[model samples]
Target: MNVFILGLGNVGKALADTLRAQGHHVEGSTTTPAKVESLAQHVDKVHVLRGDESEKLAEASQSADVLVVCVAPDVKKTRTKEEREQHYQQVLEESCKSAANACQRVIFLSSFSVYGDGGEGQEPISESTPTANHDEPSSKYYQRAENHVLASSHGCVLRFPDMYGAPGDLSFSERVKMAIDYFGGNAIFGADAPLYAIHFEDVVASVVHAINEELSGIFNVCDDDNLPASNQQVFDAICAEHGWPALTFLNQIKAPNRKISAAKIYQSGYRVKHPDPNLQYLS
Candidate 1:
């Protein structure tokens, strides 16, 4: 199989490496030219291009069986609404349009933020759950991105929560420390929102399963069985353990507070290797 991965960041890099190891002809892209040499060691080819570069994406994805769009928004650049809109337009919407145009099979890497607190209930979010119409940048643009891909018959959207268990991922404590020191406790997400997350390993597995089984439409790829610890619970424990001040939240409900069900993908025979978050108690 010929696979083209757009955005050679952590998730994209790991997916590319896994696909290559499985004997697929993998080609990936990175916006940073400086990272090309390092990324080249993992895939068959590397293209230095941004998501909005339609010509480059189409050219790079030539004869590719699948095009995985995994672009991430530049958080530093998205401080205002205008900045967020422009960044997401280029990163999510435009890239997805290019991917859909370039390949018949388009798999988008999306976030659970699309669900937006999952209403007022604790019901597990399924693929059928109506995506909340929040004004947040992530919720809005991610839905726009998902639409572009799902517009095609073979398009697939795999939605995940906050990702961890990867080589490049920061530990939960490190994230809290950064929030306290760097952002001055203005954490974008709500403190009390249940912190549902998925391992990077499961992320790779879900994408591979979608490609191999020709699965289409949306699937929530998360560890839904266990009770999720809220961000406040986790971060407060981390801060207390390290004798640091608690990180503050903007009280923004960016992601689904409700547990997200992966039963749809499981029914399709995709096993989540890391079902338990294992961080059962932070303190």
Candidate 2:
């Protein structure tokens, strides 16, 4: 099988390598030329191309068996709110068009942000839950992006929670720094707020599971636990171990604070390799 990945970021590279190791040929695209060297280590072929580049997409996607889109918008690059939204929307639309035209099947990796902090409901977010982010640009683009891929008859969507463990990713260590810098060594959200997240390895495993099972439609890919510990619980443990002043939890910022479910994936013969985030988040 020839797997073509549109982005060679952490999740993309992981997926490419896993498929390659499983005796499938993999090709990938990266926005930066410098990263091609590292991406080449994971896939058989690497192409340096922006997500919206048509000719490049044509070449890289040639003879693709399945095209997995893992492109993430660099929201910091743009200065204004409008620019940010337009940039992401444009790139996603172009990528979707290319994928629909170039590949026989498409797999899209999406974020849980589309659920919009799980809204006022205390129930865990599930695949059946309607997206509640149509107002905000950052959260709303995911809907537009997902729509693009789903337009394809053979498209599959995998929605994941916070993916940690990759370099530069917001893992526990970075969370500590963020605790100090962003939160004044405190938590803006409530201490007991539920934090739905997933380890990077589990993310890769779930993607592989979906591909292997040929599953389609929306699937919320999260850890086995629908309700995980609060951000304060996880951060406080780390803060205490390091002798750093434990972060004071307050209702300063409003963010997602509820359980996220992955039962749909489990019922589909797809089990998370790392079902518990507590086992991996600390490391």
Candidate 3:
């Protein structure tokens, strides 16, 4: 099958690589010329697309069996709030239009952030859970994108959990560093807060399975473990793996409200390639 992946970010590139490795024709698009060359190393073709350009969007989306929208607004300090939101909304609209016109199946990369604070005791969030439009500026934009894709008849939305793994670029190491710097080598969260994550390899496998099966609908993609652990526990795991100092945990900190159940994807005969999140860091 021929697949076109829009937004050549970490996740998008991973998906393209996985598909190509499985003998599927894969094409990808990136906003940066440099990234285009990088992506070309993994897929058959790479198109440099300006996020605001409608023609590029149509061209990329119009000639594929499956279209995956993985473009996400940078949460880092690259653009102003309004600028970021406008760019994301425009990309969402353009991508959706292109996909609807050409692609038989569309897969959207969405975030569990749409679920917002899962509230106290919300152990494992399913596709049925009512989502909260997070108050955070970035999360709000993702929620809007999720809504746009799901409203389409041919779109499949994957509400991804916190994804982490190899390739360094997409790992949790940077996040660990940031937390340590901010909290003086300490991180905090409630003891019962459910923490969710998916390995990069597993993410790719799920996408491959969905495309091969032409699965449509919203599915929460996450690990089987829904048990909540403190930020300190996560930090310690990384620290121990990397031979660093363990961070302290503050009991007063509440866990972020986001956890997803991947049971639906599993029941669809999609097995995760990397079941253990901890093994991802070690590998």
- Supply candidate 1's per-residue lDDT for 237: 78
lDDT of 2: 0.74
Compared with the true structure, what per-residue lDDT tens digits does model 2 show for residues 1-283? Answer: 8888898888898888899889988998988888878777899999888777877787878888888888877634433457757876766667866776777588888877677666777677678877875755655777777887888778888987667677668757567776687646665455665666677878788878877788778898876544677777787777777778887775433335677777888888766665555544455
Reference-based lDDT, residue 31, model 2: 82
**Residues 1-283, model 1: lDDT tens digits:** 9999998888888888888888899999998889989998888899988778889888989879999988888767765677877887778888998898888889999988888878776667788888884687778889988998999989999988878888967877777777777777667888777887778888888998898898999998876567678888877777788898877777554666766788888889986777546275462
Q: How many clashes in each candidate?
A: 0, 0, 2
lDDT of each: 0.83, 0.74, 0.67
RMSD of 2: 3.7
lDDT of 3 by residue, 1-283 (tens): 8888887777788887778888989888887787666677877888887545657666766768788877665534323546646665666555655555555577887777666656556466778776664544445666666665667666788877667774755456667776567657655334344456677777777877888887888887776554444344565678887777776655332334545577898899876565545445534
Clashing pairs in 1: none
List the candidates' TM-scores in order: 0.93, 0.82, 0.77
Sort every candidate by lDDT, greatest first.
1, 2, 3
Worst 10 residues of 3 by lDDT: 250-259
lDDT of 1: 0.83
Best by lDDT: 1
